[model samples]
Target: MRRLQSPRRTYDWGSREEIPDFLGQPVDGERVAEVWLGTHALAPSLVDGPDGPRSLLEVSGELPFMLKILAADRPLSLQVHPDAELARAGFDAEEASGTPLDAPHRVFKDPHPKPEMVLALTTFDTLVGFRPTAEILRVLGALPTSLTQKLAERLRAEPGFAGIVALVEQLVTDPPTPQEVGDVVAACADGVQRRTDVKRAYLTALEVNEHHAGDVGVVISLLLNRLTLQPGEAAYLATGIIHAHLKGMCLEVMVSSDNVLRAGLTSKHLDPQGLVRCVSGGMSRLARVEPEQFGESTDVFSPGLREFALSMTQVSPAEPAGTPLPDQGRRIIVCTGGEVELVNEHDERLPLRRGSAVYADAADGTIRAHGTGEVGQAYTPTAEDRATPLTDLV
Candidate 1:
């Protein structure tokens, strides 16, 4: 097993304190948003070897997937990703146009679709997708006059996803007047005073407006799904699903891709056209991922994917598995609490602590982890397992 170095992605929406405090470090007073632990070219994680530091991408060469820990302080952008074909076409177009890969305005970064799973480490909140039409109507109807008038007309028409698509399209196509924007903000501000049930989303709308100014995400947030996940709870977003992480920290793992089509809640580049094309305009409900309990300390969360699988094991000093793990795929074991001794196939022990993660090669069969700590493992499948469809696995 080799210790791996994870990369941190700092964006403007990041809180300067939350993540640092979580790791038991002095809040660096600097905005620390996301920590990337996979093999996305932008900032692929590094693993230490006797010679030097090697990127995870170079190490996991032909391997099919990547794993990560995503800790967010404030909120991420309202965005969606394209399916593989669209991703490939967009990437090729950007390259052909001579657009720098690192350019802020560049949209497609790679040709891979990103289907992600995020499990809350705290009470995490987000706007996932559209809520039911009646629920949305109730939330919008409760708003103060001018703002309600603007949204009420269209929402009352019950246009479903198409109506929502049109409303968002119109707002983005013909930018709202400065006075009109002020009216919406004022309405949200007034609604905040009323303290309605949708107060959380209303507050988010105001913050989003201030962040992106006139971006259409503020209005979109109103019509999307509002979700809150307790610790150990998880949510899954498939290809073309529109969503945004609102607040608090979480552990996130996904297919290896960094392409995001932004509508708002960010100072970064906004890909309105791409975002519009990517959104599904359907009601996406909360993802229910029940942990599969095995013995007392181990619980597995497999979202029925060929690319990867994750497991969360709660270790008590009294209960220790004396044997080796069943996984044969490339595995990354991360310890979130206490310390653990990982014994290799040859019986070599690797000591790991909180926040420490190690990469174990696929061929390293039946490894043993015996100690008192909370650990999670991520891995890809073998040929035989890969041949089996995900539906059957579930």
Candidate 2:
């Protein structure tokens, strides 16, 4: 097992202090978005080695999965990720067209699909998938404007996921005018001010408008499902599912790829057509992940994805015994709370405190934690298990 120094990323939508606070470090007044914990060329974690610190990629070739500590103070972009096939195709096409990898408009950074899950460390708010047709109509009816009315009419005519896709395509492909966006925002704000039981759709729209002023995502927010996950709760988003994480901190694990097809709610490059192609034409409800508890405080979060799975174990002062770490695949363990010591089969140990992370090679054999703390472990799943369709998982 090797101690790792993870890379911190700062973004405009990041929380200024949450990540630093989690790491037990002084806040630098900069927005710390994510602390990347694996070997992806973009921001690889450094592993403490016998010869000094070295890139994780040098120690363990490219990992199939990447883990992260994501802290989003503001809303993220309304975006979708492509599936494995689409990712490979898009990456090859972009390469063939000679689009520089560093170009702002480059969509695919790697050829792997990204299917991620967020385990809430705090109350997390996010928008995912499409709302049911009836709920969407109700929200539209409350607005009663030309843009919304037109979308509502189209949805009413099609009345399923197709309608939702059409509505999104229309909004992204041929966006509403600034005047139209302003009208919708005004209507939503008025509704929030007047209604005793304000609809979450309108509230979300008003909130998104505050940050992204006249962006079309303000209106698109109404079409997606709004979810609030309490601490310990998790939600899995498969490839092609449109989503925007709105608030709070979470531990995100996914296939090692950075390809994103964004539509709106961001200052980054927008690819309306690409986003349209990546979106799944099926409607889905909130993808809440139910953890399987073992012994007392160990919660295993497996979204049936062969690429990755996460297990969080909480140890108390009364019971100081640490749980045994997985012995097969390469694993990364992060201490989320308190302090602990990771002991390997040879009795060698590494001290870990809150926000401390370590990388364990498969050859390290059985490892155990010792102390009172909470640790999250990310590892690759066995290849023998048949893959579960993302549609069924959602």
Candidate 3:
């Protein structure tokens, strides 16, 4: 196992204290958003070697999956990722259009689908997928506005997933005027104060408007489901599903891609048409992932993604020799709590502390944890399509 130095991403929506405190570092008053622990070209982890510190890409090439510690103080952009086919087409078209890869308005960063899962380390709040059409209609009915009333009438007339999609597409593609948006926000705020049944929907609308006033995403937020996950709870986001991570820290694992099509609630580039094309208009079932326990204190969270799977193993001092980890395929192990020594079958050891990460190649046979604390492992399952192992790439 090789020790790795991961890179932390600082974004405007990140908490200044959460990541620093988690890493046991002195608060430097910087918004640390995510600590990336993989060989994605955008923010690859570093590795210490005979040639001194080197990029993880140089040591292990491209990893099929990327793991991250994400801490959001505010809401992320309301966005959706395209499927593989759409991603490839979008990337190729953009490349042909002479858009620089680093351009601010560039939508596709890579030609790969990003299906991700987030395991809450804290009370994680997120707006994910579309709520039931009935719930959305009810919320809209509670709002006192001609626009909302008209929307409710239309939805009631159709009353199904198709109507949900049509309403979303209409609002996103041909958005309401700024004055109309403000009126909607006002109505939502009033409803939030008065209606308990639609409280969550209105509260979310108020929050979105606070961040991005007069933005149509405030209206869109009412269409999605609001989920609050406790620690150890997880939610999976498949391609074409819109979501916004609202608050709290979580472990996010996904295929190595950064292609996001955004609609609103962000200062970033807006692509309503592209997002509408990429996002599904139908109601999305909540993807609440339940952990499958294996051995004592080991819970494997496999959301059935072809590229990645995550397992959280907790080791106590009483059980010095912790659980045996999956020894095949490339793995990235991150220590979330306490210190632990990662030992291999060859008696080689790599010590890790809170916030530390390590890269273990497939050749590193049967690994075990030794110490007290929790560690998360991200790896490709044996059942996955190994024909295109990312390590084959330079």
C-alpha lDDT values of all predictions? 0.72, 0.86, 0.84
Question: In model 1, what lDDT does residue 157 have?
Answer: 79
Worst 10 residues of 1 by lDDT: 385-394
lDDT tens readout by residue for model 1, 1-394: 7888887677776768766654556876778887766677777778999899998768877445566556665568888878777889999999999998899998888878877777777788877767666777777777765655667688677557777676666665565665666666777888888777473667777866766665566777877777788988777677787888877777777777878898776778887778878877366644656666545566666666777666777766575554345476587887777878888877777888877888888556677777777777777644443332222100
Candidate 2 lDDT tens digits, 1-394: 8899998998899999999999989998999999999998889999987788999999988888899999998999999999999999999999999999879999998899999989999999999988888889998987868988888888889998887898999899998887899999888878888782134888898888888988999989998888888988888898999999999999999999999999999999999999999998467745677776656668777778888888898866555556675435698999999988888878888999999999997677777788888899988865432132222322
Q: State which candidate has the highest lDDT.
A: 2
State TM-scores per candidate. Answer: 0.89, 0.95, 0.93
Worst 10 residues of 3 by lDDT: 385-394
Question: Which residue segments of model 1 deviate by more than 4 Å?
Answer: 21-27, 206-215, 321-326, 381-394
lDDT for model 3 comes to 0.84
Per-residue lDDT of 1-394 in model 3, one digit per residue for the tens? Answer: 7888888898888999999988888999999999998988778899888878899988788999999999999899989989999999999999999999889999998889988989999999999888787788889888888888988999999877778777878888888887998999888767766665473998888887887888888888988889999998787888988888899999999999889998888888989888878876457855777677657778777777668888888877766665687546689999999988888878898888898889988678778898888899998865532222211100
- Between prediction 2 and prediction 3, the one with superior TM-score is 2
Once superposed on the true structure, which residue ranges of model 2 sit more than 4 Å away at CA?
196-199, 317-321, 383-394
